[model samples]
Target: MSWKTFPKVELHLHHEGAAPPAFIRGLAKEKSVNISGVFAEDGSYVFTDFVHFLSVYEAATQVLKTPEDYHRLTLAVLEQSAANGVVYSETFLSPDFCGNRDLSAWREFLHAIREAADQAERDMGITLRGIVTCVRHFGPDKAKQTARCAAETAGDWITGFGMGGDEGQGRQGDFAYAFDMAREAGLRLTTHAGEWGGPQSVHDALDDLRVERIGHGVRAIEDPALIERLVAENIVLEVCPGSNVALGLYPDVASHPIARLRDAGVKVTVSTDDPPFFHSTMTQEYEQLEQAFGWDEEDFAALNRSAIDAAFCTEDTRARIIKRLESQ
Candidate 1:
């Protein structure tokens, strides 16, 4: 069955990473910026590996320099998500990219993005929320600045704080202070773990950072004890199977641990971490999972229910999204 119109709740999209290659190319040409190295002859992003992907990702983001640029980006991203039936989505926004962790500048960028999001909601009936994120590779000091930006803007719109970027950079504990600051400001927390780092990384994120959810916590399958703990603690995993396979973490979707993790009673939700970068969409992810694991509409509906439960949005927003999901 085609999953194109199936309502989905996404919780782990990266704002900059979601930029479509064609959009980036257009922006680059308009700004006279050269980012031809990041794209292939077919106009899709090209990267040798995860680390190289980061470089290419950053190179592509170089053309997005102003609040207006982010405004356009937010609209373009939401249009893609809406097309694929993503009813509600929470996107990771890095102050490092927005305004170099400057509070005032970040606020300006946030305003533009929020304005676009509001417009999208009214026009397309797709809700968008922001999660302020710190780039792990940028180090702990910069993370504190990003966290401060998050704290200053802690509200209904900016609901959560997370850490993204290379999980191999530093231990999750190294950024405890930043996480603590965000927590103090009443922000929900989540961080990248178990994707590049081992199962131990998931433990560190839980024991140290105290996050309620984990981004790409697929490696937990390698440790039975960790899987049990995740279930016991009810920590949601934002599993991006396509992103994992695209980065060569797994050979294909059939080899991905999402099905195993779900069968083991772990709360797993689907997301397109960087859809364009991974050449994936919400509908495409559903199709792949269905083909690989024989997941039917009921399975996907359950996944969507789990996703809305784990989403960082307010109760009112959650209820509205749930209503839409049920109506569909």
Candidate 2:
């Protein structure tokens, strides 16, 4: 009944956010960066709410000042994910954090991350892909620069573009120009919506940015019509129940709407968004879902199929991930 070895696919994860506290502490010590405010005495990340979590998250990222940091980070994250049964993972990477939107510098960071990804794939059997992301709180103009970075890097490794950060800062439509650039460059699109911003945020993301998937679209469960639309359009949701609970979107896993959304025929996939921050793993997510919704291995298998179908990887990579899921 253990889910630790079950093959899984993750569609939503933040690269810097996935760094383990111990790793961050070690990196901070090595760099002599004063990021003590970001962690508790026990060494876990300490934040009171979502906005505060963002601040703490950014604080932790201070130690990751170069491409080499990201390279090591990619390996650390992938090793943890692989141990937790994640076979395929798509991580959100921000050019702002990588190189302050400088194209050449972003490429260097991308290359370093990709090298680590290749190593992880070879050693850990976990396929890693990047989704270049624009921080919504950084505003639309900055988003344009981030999009330009994404457009330039659209390829087999960096296959998707998305918006993450404070969804409450601006409407999804505000970043239309940025999303358009990424779309025209052949990068698939997704955006954070409906977690704190509510059902209308999901509506705006679909009607404006036209993303194929939504990060934390659980609030769509509040509106029957939205749920119906998601089903009709086959829009996928990258649901992170543990993250939601950790951030007080829901009191606990049982109160989360992922089950309700899935039962409504919505294409829902599970992920541990900033796993260590949420004190979760792919295994923990499965265990919580199984306990809350009574989801069995069959349910999880179907979820993996849906995730693979919605993944932004190339068809060959998708097929390979599907095989891994089936082999279980």
Candidate 3:
């Protein structure tokens, strides 16, 4: 049972970040955008660190100025993900990128992306759902607008709300107003924490934002009480092992706390946070986990089941996906 054949679910992916370098390059060529430094001569996103990665990410996004651009991006990303054995994925979509904080433009962008997602599900057998995310580094006032857009568009395809960006920018409580708005809209919640902020950031996200999931929560392992609380509450951590390693969050995959956190009874699921940027896919993620932690087929299956259970989808859709997993 090779990892490439394993049925996997991803819960912490960014829509723009998942765009393959070649896809971004093609989009740039079509739009005649001068995003030359976005990719290297070898065709990979070039960045020095997380800060520069965000800059390159935004530079590549400049080519995606129209709704059609996002549609093409969705198709390209999902096609690649399907080829890598991703059966289900929930990707972060930002209004800042799509609409520039204008509700009208956001609606148009969302429509195009959702249409492409529907087609991807039909053609690629990969179910795609969106998590409307507010860019934290963009400031709290702007995040409120992004949250408003997400709250207004709580549909079957757009199932969740999240915050992404520089975790070190401000306190999580600063974004409480936006999270409250999403909560009122009945959207499932998650937030980026513990990547750069450590255990206290994870605590703030849990206590203030009240998210059902935490993105890149590997740092919670440092706080024994926080780990206990997470396990008791059944909050899932959308752990991206390869991304952490690539970003220098951990020195190596062997030093990652994913196995330790799972052993502590904290619900954990695997994901490729930014596939192309991190130079990983679902197949590579599972393969690396197997090599590092001695995980087997049953372990992978259990991880998939945990992801499905934690997924924010309709019961009918969940049942359908569960059946597909069982059949596999």
Candidate 4:
């Protein structure tokens, strides 16, 4: 049951959302900022509902105001992930929080993060790629700026662009231009859908944004036709069962649809969306899947294979990760 040594790939983590509560609290204390309401006395993020969760999540980011802070955060998060057997991960990075949507400043912050990632890979043996993301409720105009920042940095490190926020905000179609901009700049696309919105949200992401992947697309299980389309198109769902259950999308992992989606031939991959917020780690995710559905090492390997294939990383990096997974 100790899944910590099992090699894994994660494709849907949030940068700021992944910050450990103690890290943020330290920053807050250093800056003389009193944000006691954001955390429980036990040192975990505290929120009662999804909307409040987003609010608390954003509040925690307030303490991460500079590139150095993010650098330190990158190191801490990567160390934790490495401890959980993540060999490679693609995290959702938002320029909105990195530098308030400023391209020049975003680059500075990115440099710090990449440097930290380089060190983490050397020390912890975990590689990281970023997916520059736009906050949905922040609206389309700001999304354009976020897209521009992503476009300017689309390369080996920042390999993709996506959206994450309240899916109930403006229609996915409203953000097509932003996604288009990122796509034209050679960034693979994805977005948060079917987490708050229904099956139609997943359809809209495919139809409007033309994303190759869906963040939390498990809700598509509600529409068998949409599920078929996902399987037929081979679109990957960045399923975060822990996050979903923590946010009440499902009451518990036992009731989550990841197993159903996999059985239905959907190319589903596992990830801890915002691990600290959900009180999970890659090891815990695997353990829960095993307990809930009788999954084992072979099942995890297949999931990792699906995630690597769907990942936005280069073929060379993919090959290296595959080699590691095989050797494990």
Q: Report per-prediction Cα RMSD to one decimal.
A: 0.6, 0.6, 0.8, 0.7
Clash list (residue pairs), candidate 4 = none
lDDT of 4 by residue, 268-305 (tens): 99999999999999999999999999998899999999
Clash pairs (backbone) in predicted model 3: none
Q: List model 1 lDDT by residue over 237-305, tens digit each.
A: 999999999999999999999999999999999999999999999999999999999999899999999
Question: Each candidate's lDDT (Cα)?
Answer: 0.96, 0.95, 0.92, 0.94
Give candidate 3's error at residue 1 in angstroms: 2.9
Sorting all predicted structures by lDDT, with the top scorer first, yields 1, 2, 4, 3
Q: Choose the strongest candidate by lDDT.
A: 1
lDDT of 4 at 302: 98
Local accuracy of candidate 2 as per-residue lDDT tens digits, 90-129: 9999999999999999999999999999999999999999
The TM-score values for the models, in the order shown, are 0.99, 0.99, 0.99, 0.99
User: Which ranges of candidate 2 are over 4 A from the true structure?
Assistant: none
How many clashing residue pairs are found in candidate 3?
A: 0
